[model samples]
Target: MDEPRRNLVRWLLGGGLSASLISFLYPAFKFMNPPDVPEASVNEVSAGKVQDLKPNTGKIVKFGSLPVLLVRTTETEWRAFSAVCTHLNCTVQYKESSHQMWCACHNGLYNLNGQVVSGPPPHPLEAYSVHIRGDEVVISRRA
Candidate 1:
């Protein structure tokens, strides 16, 4: 083969191999350390209607990626708290019988106001202010 022709083929092969490696590695690197997705700024969350939650009952509402527990302590009183367990990041639920938030994963207890009552929880659940807009229940982060 001519010298020029040999050099051209070598250059093309190297370029092709480099492109192939980059194509395979780019996705792997992305998967390992994925880019951060911009979170939607959520100042408040609508839990549900007043009738949807009976007295002394609890419901879970999505506040961004995490869950928020909404509890109706009385006929007119409503409360909201972060549903993620402080101990292990487990989702918590409202136990009507216990009348408080309970994390079944580690037996963590949080009061209606989000204070840690017992178990392995290190801190209290994040509390959100509750407001009643007619029939709808509104929950917002405290100032």
Candidate 2:
């Protein structure tokens, strides 16, 4: 076409290409480098039965607004994880004998250590720290 028309077409094409590139790159960048891991409040989470929480059993404990999973291993060690599922952030339930943590919302299953064994979980459940304080079992964030 004429010089004026050709110049206008070239400018439009370049602008469109740049916009497309930025649109694709923006999300990729966000996904690659996540915003940040939020700071979890540090407090003692008391769960029932440091004694009744028998081996291979788990219970849900709360510290302020946070929900944590407390599990008793076969070796009598107390382990803790964030009760929030890694996939959709749903709460998880505990099976005492099988030692498997079950998320009924999507049928997601995790081992006592919070490792996903089945269903659509994207990552292993986050493990925290637990200890015995006074007569209560305390679950807390690891430093």
Q: What is the per-residue lDDT of model 2 for residues 1-143, given as tens digits with 9 covering 90 to 100?
A: 59999999999999999999999999999899967777776666667656777777777777667778887776558888888988898999887656788888998999876888999998998888877876577776777
**Residue pairs with backbone atoms closer than 3 Å in model 2 (clashes):** none
Which pairs of residues clash in candidate 1, taking residues 3 or more apart in a chain or in different chains?
none
Q: For candidate 1, what is the TM-score?
A: 0.77
Root-mean-square deviation of every model: 5.4, 6.4
Backbone atom clashes (below 3 Å) for every candidate: 0, 0
The regions of model 2 sitting more than 4 angstroms off are 1-40
List TM-score per model, in order: 0.77, 0.63
